[model samples]
Target: MSGPRIDPSLYRERDVVPIRRALLSVSDKTGLLELGRALADAGVEIVSTGSTAAQLLEAGVPVTEVAAVTGFPESLDGRVKTLHPSVHGGLLADLRLEDHERQLDDLGIRPFELAIVNLYPFAQTVAAGAPAGEVIEQIDIGGPAMVRAAAKNHANVAIVVSPDGYGEIRDALASGGTTLEQRRRLAAAAFAHTAAYDRQVADWMAGETGQADRVLRVEATLSAPLRYGENSHQRAALYTFAEGRGIAQAEQLSGKEMSYNNYVDADAAVRAAYDFERPAVAIIKHANPCGIAVASAKAVDPIASAHIRAHECDPVSAFGGVIAANRTVTLGMAEQVADVFTEVLVAPDFEDDALAVLRRKKNLRILRLPADYRREIREFRQISGGVLLQTADSFDQGVNSAQSDSSAWRLVSGEEVDAATRADLEFAWRACRAVKSNAILLADAGASVGVGMGQVNRVDSCHLAVNRAGARAQGAVAASDAFFPFADGLDVLLQAGVRAVVQPGGSVRDDEVIEAARRAGVPMYFTGERHFYH
Candidate 1:
């Protein structure tokens, strides 16, 4: 399976490789014309394929078609134009190796000092929801072959894969050609480019053929290296999917760089805020939501009202927390937020006056979400030796789904409450999903008044929620992320005078829990679904 290998001693190391002849084939023509002119002005012969050749010719840059060198007409809809040995031999030849040089001379093939190539838009086409046939046609073969060949022989040839390198290549040529170090860097980048392309194709084909589980390939480009991770002792950096749209793509408008914990809490806050349909806000600390609330439909300055209610849940914890809003941040919200010490504030957008007010606090990190922000369907978690992948905990399934329709819920005990209490129960259920398990959330008037999360036992979570709510628990509705195994947790909420409760009912002691709620004269509904977030 291995090809012929040349002894290392047979070839000499190159310091600077001058471009006498170049091959340019590109799908992205961003800097093609300028690069072509630079090479042409340097008297470097340009050999191009199909559209690339036509583009150079139109731009008045002398170019020879690849078919001219291969002595083969364009065939297979231009798919076979550059696959011939004449093209690759020139790229792979090492002039220092007399054998390679003699073989090129015998075949009348001129060695190329440069190869500029970018593959077809395979990832873009897939993301655009193109059909299978069209996507297949974009899986480039000849381009990757030439790129790999040139990159492998980088000691003799300089490979340029992106327009971002055009200026450097031109500058190097002006200084007497690209140095070996420059060629090596370009070779590394070229390999990465081809690797990402192949990953996209493989992943897409896996999905199309219903074999996603057979193999896994996760690829992301580095965005930045943080000052530190959760602690100074840990190291961390941010990596973003090439075609992803999320917090990593968010624009930081002001303040210092984001830390690892900041990104985690900010993402959790955003997810919690967007879980509601109305204007909403979420305050997060340590990847857990301390408070989340949605404003009434008729409220004026809705976002401000949501922020006030959310902050009221636990003012002590919200002081240095990360805040996220589902809608635009306004002047009203900005004024209130300015009074508090906050780590970060993220939103879809901000009013001019709001941004001006927030800018006064130099340490507060403000972020404007990307225009195409969206929630990812799949989630990944790294374990000791492997990764765990699953569908994200979403509100698009089970009884209490995205519509937040309470009609689908089963009332197990007491009388059904009024419309207002029903809305509060639904709001409580949605907000609890953002909390860590065993989770408990209390809501009143579309705002969270209490949250107890990350507890080892459900009973402790109940007591924590009741204690946090104080007098608010007297008439508030409570939501448990999962079913109550026994009546002990339900008894804690009942003793707090909670007016209503909602929990997924699938416990062996469900009957006992229902009996307790009946005795307390409190309405309890079963959603037949759990939202554990650990």
Candidate 2:
């Protein structure tokens, strides 16, 4: 992870000795019986732990208990099982070093040629929300120690850390055992396993305490080496964060590789969908929302507008947009968007019926993220020799926690909103809050009619919204991710006939903007926080 440490040149032509003696201990019993039997059949002696030995015996696999090999039974609540010199000597002895061999012979210690081990389920238990006591109980001390020792002597000892390696183990044994190259690769895997395991433990503790010093998990996926970064001559590669929960983790369905901007905006659209209660879709272009709509949970083609609302917002810029949905994607929806020159369709899952239709558009990017997944994307961007690393606002806890506090976006209209209108306002607020900064949104009932985002200034964004809404901007509810910087921004809204406005009321010129709204006779509400995505 810290880049490759060992040089590839050093591993070439390496000599390896077959493993004739191995120490095997694992709390996870998966494939243990088969592995022990295979090693025994290959003429390798097996040293195991308490229940592991019992299980191997029951399975008719020849094995020696750790006590038999180390002359030390597990003590101190099973902590002292493999800490003795006998166990350590077997793992650490260098077969090629005469001094090490002489010392081992003088002490009558056996040099183990292989160590097969997998640690206790620390990450799995922690992830299951176990109590700290149980999690601590699952941490393996002796297992990691043996793994490290065996990997250190990988020059002579082969270390296996994963059950998936059983096939390679058998192959090695059948093919006159493993060569040194295989041992090195196995050792690399062993160390990576331990490193990942340790990082997991550290991250779980960090998350429990709300500590940020050590990342809960590093977010990274490798990208191909580029001919050049920024400039065509610079070397560059792309990477995706491997952590966080969300649709981003879905296996690739099909399409060209995602570009840097595609991923950034797709993340925005998906996170926005998580905020809405009902099924919703947001079509994003260039990191900003272009078309957004919501409907009944059972509504088909949720983004499709009714005849009256079809002309409410311009769909010209909606071309090549990334659309994300909260519920399963269906055929009706696929057909509607399939006509548009869309780039990607991301959803919780895609129905086979929908997939059957969407696949014909071979170039359309399709992604299926996990249901109820949350992604907190964080990464670095560089400009002019300066690098910036920032945490991405991928999920809104405020949106998710609205039952206890819709305090973030309170509608304060002079004309009281009836229940139906209030519900629509909340829906509109949720949809609008997810657009990019310098944003303005216009919605009729529960569906968006106009959206403008990421402008150089809020007033220009207002123009973009009003222009897009055209005549339909009249009498539509308006929402802003941030408050107007001055009265002129609202003047643009009033000229466009916006009836109601929602904004995070924290601008220094709020009084000027409010006075303009009050004069325009437009009701305005203030939600105390800005939902800005940059």
Candidate 3:
């Protein structure tokens, strides 16, 4: 089944190739004029297609239309322009090989020394919510073909795919030609560009045809290089999907460069804060919320009040933590936040006065979230062998599939809670989802008074929550991310004087837990849904 192998010695090796002729076709015309001028001044023959030819002619650069060289009209609405043998023959011919040179000479074809090509705006068109027909039209067939042909023959042809390399290409041409090393680098970049373009097209078509799960092609560009990863010794960098949303796209207004841990904690804080409808604030450390709170309905300064209450939950842990606000940060919030040794503050926006106050902290990072920011539905996690994918845990899918509807909950023990107590239970339940597995949260008056997360057992989480809350644990409602397997964890919360509890009740010993709650004279509600964040 294998084809014959060719001898590598048959082909000639080239180091630097002079630019005697060039082909130009691009959708993104950034720096095209400058490049064309440089090529024309170098006395290089310019052959182009469609708009590129028109623009070069308009700029007083002599150009030969691709159709003229191919001896065929550009038919099929310009899609067939560069697919002919003449184009590929020029691009793919290895001038160093006598066979390829003789074939080109016999066919009266001139080989191109360089190719400048950028594909159509397929990704941007799809992202703009364009219609299927319009999006399909943006898929460039000829461009990728020519790019691949030129890249495969990089020893003879230099392929330029991005305008970012225009200055270098121009300088290289002025210096006589592109070096073999430069050609190799450009070929690598050209192939990457085409691969990403094909991925976007494949992803869009798969989704449109209802075969999205059949394929997964993840593509991202390097955004930044971090100082270190989780520790100083580990190396790391940030790669973005380039969707112009989420923490990857958040604008940093001030402060030191974000570290690997800072981005992780900041993203967690944003997720926790935005989970609630009211003005809310979340202070997070090590990807776990140290404190979280929402503003009361009648609060004068909602965001400020939320921050003050959130910080009170566990001020010691909140120190050097990342803070995220659902609402804009105002002067009142910033003034109080300035006193804390915070690492980062993220919000949708910040008032001028607030920015002035927070900017005084030299080491505090301030980030403004994108205007169209929203939580992504799909989540990906890497393991040792492969990767894990799942739908993100969302508050909107809680209980009866209704967002924070207390009526959907089943009160299995004691008397029903009043509206205020019900609100606290709802707040606690939503907030608990942001915590890691074996999570326990205690809330009162719309604020988290205690939080215990990342524990191995439920009983230890209960004890930790109570210890953090101290006196505040009395009369506070508790929310568990999962059901209590035994009565021991429930007993700990009851001993702390927790007035009510909420959890997904599906354990075989649910009866024991309910009986324990009844004995403590506290109410317990079952959500019939568990949120286990690993």
| lDDT of candidate 2 over 238-265, digit per residue (tens) | 6655554654466558676665556666
Point out where model 3 deviates above 4 Å.
1-20, 29-44, 55-62, 96-103, 121-139, 167-179, 204-211, 396-402
| Per-residue alpha-carbon lDDT of candidate 1 for residues 125-165, written as tens digits (9 for 90 to 100) | 98899999999999999999999999999989999999999
lDDT tens digits, residue span 287-338, model 3: 9999999997788999999999999999999999999999999999999999
The deviation in Å at residue 24 for candidate 2 is 0.6
Predictions in order: lDDT: 0.92, 0.74, 0.92
Question: Top model by TM-score, which number?
Answer: 1
Q: What local lDDT does model 2 show for residue 195?
A: 89
Error of 2 at 476 (Å): 1.3
- Worst window of 10 by summed lDDT in candidate 3: 396-405
- After superposing all C-alphas onto the true structure, candidate 2 shows an RMSD in angstroms of 4.8
lDDT of 2 at 81: 89
Give every collision pair in model 2: 219-241, 220-241, 220-242, 228-234, 229-234, 245-374, 247-369
